[model samples]
Target: MRRVQVRKTHKLFIGGAFPRSESGRTLVVEGANVARASRKDLRDAVRIARQAGAGWSGATAYNRGQVLYRLAEMMEARRGALAAACRGKDEVDRAIDRVVWYAGWADKLAQVIGSANAVAGPYFNFTVPEPTGVVGIVAPAEPALLGLVSRLAPPLVGGNTVVVIASDAHPIAAVELAECVATADVPPGVVNILTGLRGELAPWLAGHMDVAGLDLAGADGDAAELERLGAENVKRIVRGKADEQSPYEIAAFLELKTVWHPVGF
Candidate 1:
């Protein structure tokens, strides 16, 4: 008898662990049953992200960069698997390179994004970028791996934990990437990915008071409503490009803090 090939259960990645949706729901996509996350699951992810973000944001910038690079290494090791999951090898390559690119930015962002300012009073003042905390991301639908990676990397580099709604039609790549994150030395809850209907999950994330930043790049038709909900908590909302590679991307998920020191004679 031929050995049977067992199918892998595609589940939601939360707090560095894979678990079935609390609602025990699954949606079949491309003949594969993927976990369909529920509102309760979204709430859980946000709570975990908030707790994990403190330690992540407090870590040295250089350390964050190393972790990102390690993720890139993990992605590289899984290149063939990633290529099979979404799009093609080109996209997987781009996603890996993008992770590495953001890794490079982690240590240098302060130099490029911060500045000392001349003040009128007898004091010294300078502004530095800090993590926004518990950023919620809606991953775009096309070029699945690359687009998702593009949005995910910037926030991770900037030290903000993320709860991303992976592309609805193509979620395997997100789960695969989560596997990379799991082995990349990332702290639990630093990056959580949920595979489900964007329409259902995104609204909850948008209105979540604990979510300090919301990236609605893939919110599409629901962007207006989501933005409105996010406004209630004064979230830093951004609809960034799917293929963008800029320091601004990292800055979008960050908060600028200015410190003042007295220079009295």
Candidate 2:
């Protein structure tokens, strides 16, 4: 008798649990059948993200940093597998390092991006950065692992929950990364991964009123239409080159809040 191998069914990660697509559809990509996430899936992800946002955002920066560091550790432990999934060890190494880099910034972002303001009156004023709530990301098509990590880390470090549509052409790495997220002490719903056609999902994500921001790093097809939909909710839209990493990427998903206190009271 011959031993049989059981193939794994990759599903959408929503609210910390893996679930089949609401539409019960799958597309063959890269020799594998991946969930073809529908608009309903995107909407469900946004709802989960919104529900998780407050808890994740209200967490102490130190705690968030620790959680991110844990994710890096999980990635490091699975480096070989992740590297193989992405077809490049170097990209996996860089992705792990990127997570660590963002982890370090979690606690420092407030200091680096915010400041005390000088007012003429007897008032002490200061500005602070706050998470932009739920964010939607279109992960890049190539360099799948690195691009996804780069786009995800910053917003996560800044305390935003995300609904990410992984690269349709190269979604294996994203599915593997979702496993890491599930086991790395990350809060459920803080990061949801949907693997499907960008064309099918980007419009719905951009137009979602509850999603506060959109990262169109790997967006394809009508850019104008995406922007137009985003404008409906006044969402903060960021278009960037793939694999670009910067603190400003995190700032893009953050809103600055100012406070005023009586100085001589």
Candidate 3:
């Protein structure tokens, strides 16, 4: 007798658990059935991300760095699986390295980007960076693992919870990466991934009022429309190559808060 292989049913990662789409729909992509996320699913993700934002942002930068480093460790341990999902080992290596690189920046970004303003009066003023709240990311279509990790790492390291829309053409790697995030000691709802058509879900995410930032690095549709909708809430929009790396990427999702205090003699 031959053993039958059981195919995995990929679902949405929300609130630290995998769940089927609220609309109960699925689509075939690359010969596999993935959940077809709906507007409702997008709403659910935003709600959870909003709920998770405070605790994640309030967490000490040192602790955030530790969590990000743990994510890289988990990704390193699962490199074989990630490579398979991504269809190459080199991309997996880059994805892991990207995570590690961002991990190191988690605690150092404040010092690099923030500064104390020298006031001539008896007042002390300083600027500090804070998480910009929930961010919505549209992961790129090619080089799934690398693109997804590139978009995900910066915001997370900056202490922002996210609701990400995975690559429509290559979603298997995103689902696999979600599993990595689950075991990486990341808190619930901190990093949610929804797998479906970008055209179907990007609109809801861009227009969502609760989402503080939007990353359209992988967007395949009308850029003007998404930007216009995102403007309704004045969401911080980031458009660029998905695999691009820089400290400015992290700054895109952070808010610089300035404080002033009286300096006594």
Candidate 4:
């Protein structure tokens, strides 16, 4: 038997600093060293996400669209690395396409998913999609690259920042994706990704009073429980349906507001 030569190290991504997990723990995955994310890391991700704040949500739609489009371009350029990191060709292709797909939606979702209505009393009403802000996402374990991209893109395209817990057993692709995200011109703190055990961190994100929304598609066995905990804040929750694909686009992630004025003299 022969062995392949490779550099071995895994780090936690917190507040934009790539550092060793605070707990000083590491785990092995497919002959590679991976950091074991700690509670502190989880909270730090949330903090960074919140700090990015309204600037992200407040960024003009055009700027956000540009960033999303940039990400798609980066994904296309690095398609091979990401696909290899995830361990599958189809997964990589799907992940790249998914990024482009979502990028194209950033400017169009408002139009495709919105509506204009006539009010009953001489008022005009319209509804538009908006990000929920500071979302906590649980990346799925299988189909590594595409799954992670799927869970992340929609919320981000909607102008929300995300604190994601990558699949503990298969976090490599996520970290690689983070590199792409950083180069994509995506503002720092827009997507804070952590690699750790969901059972250990999902509860913290689910019940974190500060987060605006929760996406538990990857929580697997704990999806229902996380949804229950999220009820405390009435945080918007998305239960990933196994049969359905990731990166779901729905109206629930949007906020609708109506405006009224006198159109006639």
**Model 4 per-residue lDDT tens digits across residues 93-131:** 777777777766677776777778777776667777777
Model 1: per-residue Cα lDDT over 118-227, one tens digit each:
98998899999999999999998887899999999999999999999999988988888898999999999999999999999999999999999999878788999999
Span of 10 residues, lowest total lDDT, candidate 2: 238-247
Ranking by TM-score: 1, 3, 2, 4
TM-score of each: 0.98, 0.97, 0.97, 0.90
Error of 4 at 129 (Å): 1.7
lDDT of each: 0.94, 0.91, 0.92, 0.78
Query: What 10-residue stretch in candidate 1 is worst by lDDT?
Result: 213-222
Candidate 4, residue 209: the lDDT equals 83
Q: What would the per-residue lDDT of candidate 3 be over residues 1-265, giving only the tens digit for each residue?
A: 9999987889999999999999999999878899999999999999999999989999999899999999989999998888988868999999999998999998898899999999889899999999999999999888889999999999999999999999889999999899999999999999999999889999999999999999998875567799999999899998857778999999999999999999896
CA shift of 97, model 1, Å: 0.5
Tell me how far the alpha carbon of residue 235 in candidate 2 is from the true structure, in angstroms, after superposition: 0.5
lDDT per residue for candidate 2 within 211-239, as digits (tens), equals: 99989988767677898999997999988
Best candidate per lDDT, number?
1
